[model samples]
Target chain A: MMIRLHRSPSSSMARLIGQPDLCSVSNWTSRENQLHNRSSRATEQLVALCKWLEMRMTKLIAGTTISLDGFTADAKGSPAALYADFAELQQSEAMQHAYRTTGAVIMGRRSFDMAEDPDSYAEDYEFRTPLIIVTAKPPAKHPKEGNGVSIIFATSGVADAVRQAKQAAGDRDVTCVGGGMLIQSLLRESLVDELQIDIAPVILGSGLRLFENVDQRKLKLTSATSLAGGRTSLVYEPL
Target chain B: MMIRLHRSPSSSMARLIGQPDLCSVSNWTSRENQLHNRSSRATEQLVALCKWLEMRMTKLIAGTTISLDGFTADAKGSPAALYADFAELQQSEAMQHAYRTTGAVIMGRRSFDMAEDPDSYAEDYEFRTPLIIVTAKPPAKHPKEGNGVSIIFATSGVADAVRQAKQAAGDRDVTCVGGGMLIQSLLRESLVDELQIDIAPVILGSGLRLFENVDQRKLKLTSATSLAGGRTSLVYEPL
Candidate 1:
């Protein structure tokens, strides 16, 4: 039996528009992030229509490393250790498969600004596929020429950004790559299908909580694997 | 090398005084929940002195089953299935030994009120040993004469409550039985030496968070064991 997933009108998912092969991926340049010809109202309507037409079973998975005290990032917006122990996960065959199969990445604007430009790293980032950033404003920095990454800014809302990301992901899973308000909204509106939490053995004391103001949700534990260095990854699907 | 154990003066730990062996295991009676001759002030001062003399090394271990969303109990004051999945843990020889060796149990007042009295169960409760409760107000109901468990109320504060609980525990480990405001204070003061968190698959979206207002502390993961009911227990010692 084929499963058909229809757009959950419950979530006003935004319409995702890829920022045209923006700046040539070579020299660092600054371009004012602005919407050129897209009409806001028309885009929202188009996104709704596209969502109605695109009835595919793509899962929007939210993944993040949260502290034992339940913090993903600090108040100042710096993530707790960023990718410190994440490297250990790279050695896991299952983790490697996840990275290879992840079709696209969606993050909040804060994550985009905090993350180093993929071009500067020399090596392509694992999330270099396609990046959709959800923010009211665009970052001052632009991708350099030659970087194998595409950027899309969703000014509309989370629902729009998620819809755009799911459509872009096709049948593969779309990973929500940030914490804070973005994921909070995702939890609030139930736009996410799966949650993969990497529990780090530290308490940031007082930072942003991963789950706040969200209703109780009973999740089914599909998998749990312990990573070296006191970190464990837990995968869950809504029951 | 033999290490010296000492009660922490910094915490102003309380003195544990057991109620007279009341009733020979069969009957109902009503007594005002007041410490007849014990004055709060005298108890505090005596606690300080006893801890100074006792100087015995007793570890206070906090254990609670937390949901994916970090709630240990619901808003209605009921525990997340009060040790429902804990039965699997009973199979572990080490766990059984620990339960047998445990000298006392400490819990917040709410947990005490919410739990079924051991007497009502018509059998010995797993935590049939000495029980210490920390609450601002005394519970209205007292154990019917036949219940074998003993009770001590710590009204002064958490520091005093834990001190009393530790002293009663003797050389054995004292289990801080629930996750609530009392444990939060213990975490704040860095009083807990070891934390054993059982991660339950259920996510209670809006009840009570297990940890709140806690400062950042790095914890060393000592052990991780999976339970049969899809629950995983992670043990950590504060670094």
Candidate 2:
């Protein structure tokens, strides 16, 4: 179902959340209407806002492999260990459909530097979409590559990086690629809208946690499907 | 799907995970063959194992209200806030069916002590089932009460509490009530079979974490469904 955000922030609960600072919710939040307290009165606005955001913003949706313990990667930052469980999911039609909705990819600098393998840019991976890297020292701004994918670096931060990626995505969605820390920053800043995670059924006793130190926020599950090969695909909106 | 534990631990990747500490796999592990690497070879084992446990183990499941941030309660340990989101879910048929499967209820000392209401021991909540509590100090070693639910205390740790609870449960499942610390111990000890958390779509920015300081382990999701009143019911088995 397409979720829309209700802008009726007139309830006392709405008033409680309408502080100027919070009122100035990011374009990501304002566009996606990701604010939700889910309390009796507050939940109404949340539901309304969720509906609005669902339609307004080019959703910053993320597709990643997350372990049951909620780690996106191992302690050494390698993603292959746990993510390999969903190799088939990465190549599935559902995944292809998800990627087809993406106009651009936003990722941390580390992911940018590490995404050198030609196969990693396959249609199964990201379809050679335009890439915007959130970095302190972005590499030389390159226009579209031979694959027709534009690669740009945003030295500014998450918001600016997302803005550029959103513009680049046109009417499609922006995919946030991760390296944990940067993902945490985007989530903390509430720049993300939907999370499409393929949960691998393996546990690495310890690793860089997927939701590490990210601010506490409740998510409304839009869908949870048991995919082929034991991987679980979960789609959620931050309420 | 009936998940069976495929005992093909001969994969090179399986060898990587077949270490001695993990190999002293509990009778629970051996009985259920609770192990999975999720490599091409072992992923089959994980799939099989997840199904087996789902069917075999009269799981010691937890049915608690948790916030989106993975907290079971507030920092002060009060669970009134986010938990209220599931007032309707508590009265759900799904919840009632889940409770009907309960043979016993295991909880921490705090919960036992704080459960001053007569209704907490009701057929709906615990159905006056056998209540096994883990604590250093055993309250009075009471037998079955007038409510037909036996109330017992285990001064020992998680294993003993689970063992006793299992014995009392016989053919039924055990419900572990959470206060965070004890549940962490159970999860850390790898004694918990299934977690049925009703995630309230609300954020408590600061509170005691649901799985605070617990060991990191991947959980295989058995099922996830949106319950009544917007709460999401998630059932997972920790690997």
Chain B TM-score of every predicted model = 0.69, 0.70
* A15-106 per-residue lDDT for model 2 (tens digits): 45443444443454543454433234565566555434433557788667766545677777777766555557668878788777777888
- Give lDDT: candidate 2, residue A198: 63
- Cα TM-score per model: 0.70, 0.69
User: How far out, in Å, is residue B140 in model 1?
Assistant: 7.9
Candidate 1 similarity to native, TM-score: 0.70
Share of native interface contacts recovered by each model: 0.72, 0.46
The top-ranked prediction according to lDDT is 1
DockQ of the two-chain complex in candidate 2: 0.23
**Lowest summed-lDDT stretch of 10 residues in model 2 chain A?**
A1-10
Docking quality (DockQ) for each candidate? 0.46, 0.23
Q: List candidate 2 stretches off by more than 4 Å.
A: A1-56, A116-125, A140-144, A216-218, B1-58, B63-65, B116-125, B140-144, B203-205, B212-220
What lDDT would each prediction earn against the true structure?
0.70, 0.66
